[model samples]
Structures are given as C-alpha cells and as structure tokens.
Target: MSHKKALEAFYHKLRNLRGNTRFVGGSLILFSGDFRQTLLVIPRSTPTDELNPYLNSSVLWRHLHKLTLKTNMRVQQQRDASAGNFAKQLMDIGNEWIQIDESSNVSPCHQTSVRSLKA
Candidate 1:
C-alpha cells in the first residue's frame, strides 16, 4: 500500500505535467489493490501509528470512489467450482466476513494437503 503522501506527490506531479487544473488533470486513475485487506504491517508500532501513513489517512481518500470486483477471474478461467469455493473461503477470511472456530479435530483436508504441500 502506498502512503498518502506518496499518492499526493504523484497526483500533484501528474496534474502539473498534464497542464490541467483538475485533479490528476481530469485523468481517470485506476487504483487497484483491496483496501479492505490487512493494515500495513509495522514492526514495533501501534495500530494508530500504522494508520498514519495509510492511503485512507489522506484528505483525497474521501473524494475517490471505490468499485468492487464481483467475480474471481482466475477461478472462472480454470473452470473449477472447487477453486471458486476455495477462493471465496480465502477472501471471506481475509475480509473478516466469516469466522471459523478452531477445533481439536483435524480436517481431512489438512491431513491430506500437508503431505502434498511438503512434497
């Protein structure tokens, strides 16, 4: 994730280079990456401190609109329903949209995949 200052710097540079008064010289900036994902990993820093450099901390963040992607293109290309389910599960965990309780019993998947993963 880019720091807000870095984004602002590029924004101003782009605006100046294009010779337009509009933001980013009215050029559509397609900012990728999921903002909903994990916060910036900081060693020996508090959560508040970590957020200080995040893109959303900038004043420009309010003006930008967010668009969500509805489909997993990789899963679609692979033509695998199981892959879709796996991707959904991973995304759910990453987004904190679902919770799975840790149990003592090991799943058959874990038992089977461990060997394959080691190989």
Candidate 2:
C-alpha cells in the first residue's frame, strides 16, 4: 500500500476509537510514521484533507516531535517466485516499494527479480 493510504488507514482507526476516548481537558494522540506522512495526523479543530500534508514537508516537520528507524533492512535472493520469494523481497523494502517497482511481472505482493538498494 502507498504510505498515504496507510496513513488514512491509521486515521480511520483513530476515528473508530473516538467514542472510547474521554477528554477531560486535553487529548492524548500518538502518531508514528515517515516524517512526511506523520504530519498529516496532527489533530486540529479544522481538519485537513488526506493529501495535503504529504505534499508539504514543512507542515510535516513543524508538527513532528521525533524521528526514528533510519536504517534499511537488506537481503539477497536467488531467482524464485514462491511465497518465500515474496517474503524475502518484503523484508527488504516492505510492501510499499513493491507497489513502486516498474517491472510488469513483479508486483508489490509478488515479485520475480533481484532488487538491490545501496546502504
């Protein structure tokens, strides 16, 4: 899934829990994501649309409190297309990059070639 879509999913989760939360004076909100996407989740009285924050990094960093997970996970692969093959690729870049791969046969969920990224 795209990072924006994933953020929307998280937003939906929080919207689901709205009734369960009781606000005495302040609210507790936790958002964790890539620097760009996390900024979209900031709670404001006037709600922002889903696509706005991703387009503006300034808005994102302005609202960001912390950033983590700087390292990339890397792995090697032989030519294969079984479930294990999917797992190997997924481990490297996660499902998001799968969507971005340009090959016709290789999809985010199923890929069929060696993909390497520099550390």
Candidate 3:
C-alpha cells in the first residue's frame, strides 16, 4: 500500500485499540533531526474532513508531550550515567584514532624530507 494509506491504516488501528483497556501501557516514540521540519509535512495534503493523529494538537501529540516530559525527568535523574556513557564513547573514539595513527608508518626519513621542503 501507499505511504498515506499505511499511515491511515495504522491510525485507524490505534483509534480502534484506544478504546480497549487490554492494550494499556503502550507507547510510541518518534525521533526526528528537526521537529519543525517534520511537523511541516503533517496533514500532508490540504485541510481535510479527517484529522491525522500525527499532526500537532492531536490526542497523540498531547500524549507525546507527556512522554517527553517524563523522559526528560528520568534523564535528569540519570545525569551521571549519561555523562559516564558519553565519556566512554569519547574514549573509544580517541583510542580508535590513536590506533589508526600508530598503524600508519611514517618513517623519520619522510619527516626529514617534509621539513627540508619547508626550508
């Protein structure tokens, strides 16, 4: 099916499931490089009789905001863990670069030649 059709079907399924209590505690997470750019594509076509759940001011949008707030709080509580992970990643990258630089054999003769060329 087409992209629009698939999204509509997904939203329809969600609407139907929304009334059912068995599917409680479900969540949807959307990540974008630029939220404004992503929002610009909402309701892809012109204003229609039907509303898209993905658009701003929709029920899902409100839920997303709530989720974002909760996530931010949890992240704040784990600031030390986040910093540790960031430092680990930085060290890994630095070690990889060091290995690469060491592996590339540049002889002393080559260094002397480069220095002489500068003179």
Task: Return the top candidate by lDDT.
Answer: 1
1-119 per-residue lDDT for model 2 (tens digits): 13444544554566566644333113355555444323335455344454544523233234335655633433223334565566657555643554553565644777689668876
lDDT of 1 by residue, 1-119 (tens): 78899889988999899999898889999998867767878899998998999898898888789888978898999998899999999889877998666875566764433345664
lDDT of each: 0.85, 0.46, 0.46
**What does the lDDT come to for candidate 1?**
0.85
Each model's Cα RMSD: 8.2, 16.0, 16.0
Quote each prediction's TM-score: 0.69, 0.22, 0.24
lDDT of 3 at 56: 51
Ranking by lDDT: 1, 2, 3
- Which regions of candidate 1 are displaced past 4 Å? 99-119
Candidate with the larger TM-score of 1 and 3: 1
Number of colliding residue pairs in each model: 0, 0, 0
